[model samples]
Target: MTSGFWQKTGKGLAKTRHFLSAGLGSIFKKKREIDQDTFDRLEALLIGADLGVEVTQVLLADLKASVERKEVGNLETLRDKLKTSLIEILKQVPVAPPIDESPIVTLFVGVNGVGKTTTIGKHAKRLCAEGKKVLLAAADTFRAGAGEQLSIWGQRAGAEVIRFPPGADPSAVVFDATSAAMARKVDHLLIDTAGRLQTKHNLMEELKKMTRVISKQIPNAPHEKILVLDATTGQNALSQAEHFQKAIGLTGIVLTKLDGTGRGGIVVPIVQKFSVPIIEIGVGESPEDLIPFDIENFVGALFEEENP
Candidate 1:
């Protein structure tokens, strides 16, 4: 990662960093001894950071038990311990392998307004920059202007976008896009699906249909099913992940809008509950703002530690 990447990540997580430093700084300004009250207050602070009650309790228990064993003595050491614990939880999802297959098919899923289309665009740009011939499938015909939105992004990313008339069958779009990808021998095919509410069973079933279409068109196609989530949504994002997993199993997640929210800690519970590898995080509005999820940079940025 570049130095700018680390700097931007630190800036993106400034809100959460302030939250953590403030809570810990107050508790351990001049360390005397760890006590029951200290533990209780620590639990409250973590819970307030949107770690979720269960996860906070689990982490607090681990840290307190370590203190009993004399593993962590002062605030600075305890801070390091907490950082390590969080990183362990984040590491539950392993790193993804490089895209090696020709015309790799990827499907993007999520509710509306979660930056689903934007994530697709940013990734398409990255792939193109890598000299890959990328094609975008606008399978989001359900929404007005969805096709145009992707077309704009395609122009910016220097990729061709496959689409149909507004309100056309989304399956048809995927089928045609797959055929184009094969005929052109493109390196990657990114399908941008319409945003569907999880509670709407019919809409979710539609997503399943589209998934089937992609697989039928190309064996082992839709090779990647990525769920795009809004970080600012807090626990609501986790609920979205759960509901989408039931509808269409997610292979990974793209967490967006982390630049300005103290709720970035929500990433911990999302990964813990779903075990979904977070592919990347949207830190800002630019195409380059979409940075790959690096555990060290993420933790370091959030805690103001040197990027490892």
Candidate 2:
């Protein structure tokens, strides 16, 4: 492993731990005996952490059952149970599909101001370093500076970029990009789509059209529809996820801005509710800040010691 991996992974885990502790702190310090009141308090904390109502109830019941079976006796044992339960829930998420072919089309989507373009740029650079010929598509024509911003990042990553004038049809851009990728024989094509507000039906219709357009040119193109989410927004991000998933099926999620604000607990709910594997995470501003998500590393990092 490289220093970049450990550094970024460490930062992400610290943020996760901060949020998790906030949610479960009270119970973690409670007296030895496990009682109904303690269980009820723990349940409320889990729900408040945005663990989702269904998951909260299920975990609470499991914890009570464990206690009845004499499997848990103190906060230390209960904490282990909590972590184990979280990891088990996350284990059900599917892993990322193997990418061996050239010009693997990846479509990026999320609401505006969630760092979608930045994430694509970072990913493109990483892919290039892995000896892949990467291409970028500026499908986000709605935002005033989306194209120029992504184009600049493309340059930094030494990748080709396809763009059209602002106000051009978003789907049309993707259509042309996929066709170009087929001819150029690139290794990966990262397409950045216009960020649509969850409440806008017409905007969402455009996203569906983009998907349809790419699938037309290359069957099963857009092999990945990655939803980039901002961790700072907490539970509101979940509301957005629901709308986006309903609009376009998401294969996985990429969480951005994972360094602070103490709401990393939102990730728990997203996994439990949507079951979308978090394929990548961004903790800092560097290009190498993006790293593949590892559940064990993530759990360790989030609860790791604070830096000096």
Cα error of candidate 2 at position 224, Å? 0.7
In model 2, residue pairs whose N, Cα or C atoms come closer than 3 Å (at least 3 residues apart or on different chains), thus clashing, are 13-301, 13-302, 103-186, 103-187
Clashing pairs in 1: none
- Backbone clashes in candidate 2 total 4
RMSD of 2: 2.4
Most TM-score-accurate candidate: 1
Error of 1 at 256 (Å): 0.1
The sequence of per-residue lDDT tens digits that candidate 2 reaches over residues 144-212 is 989999999999999999999999988889988998999999988899988778889998888889999
Worst 10 residues of 2 by lDDT: 299-308
Let me know the TM-score candidate 2 reaches against the reference structure. 0.91
Per-residue lDDT of 178-220 in model 1, one digit per residue for the tens?
Answer: 9999999999999999898889999999999988988897878
Q: Whole-model lDDT for model 2 versus the true structure?
A: 0.81
* Candidate 1, superposed: residue stretches over 4 Å from native: 305-308
Give the top-scoring candidate (lDDT). 1
**What TM-score, computed on C-alpha atoms, does each candidate reach?**
0.95, 0.91
All candidates' lDDT scores? 0.88, 0.81
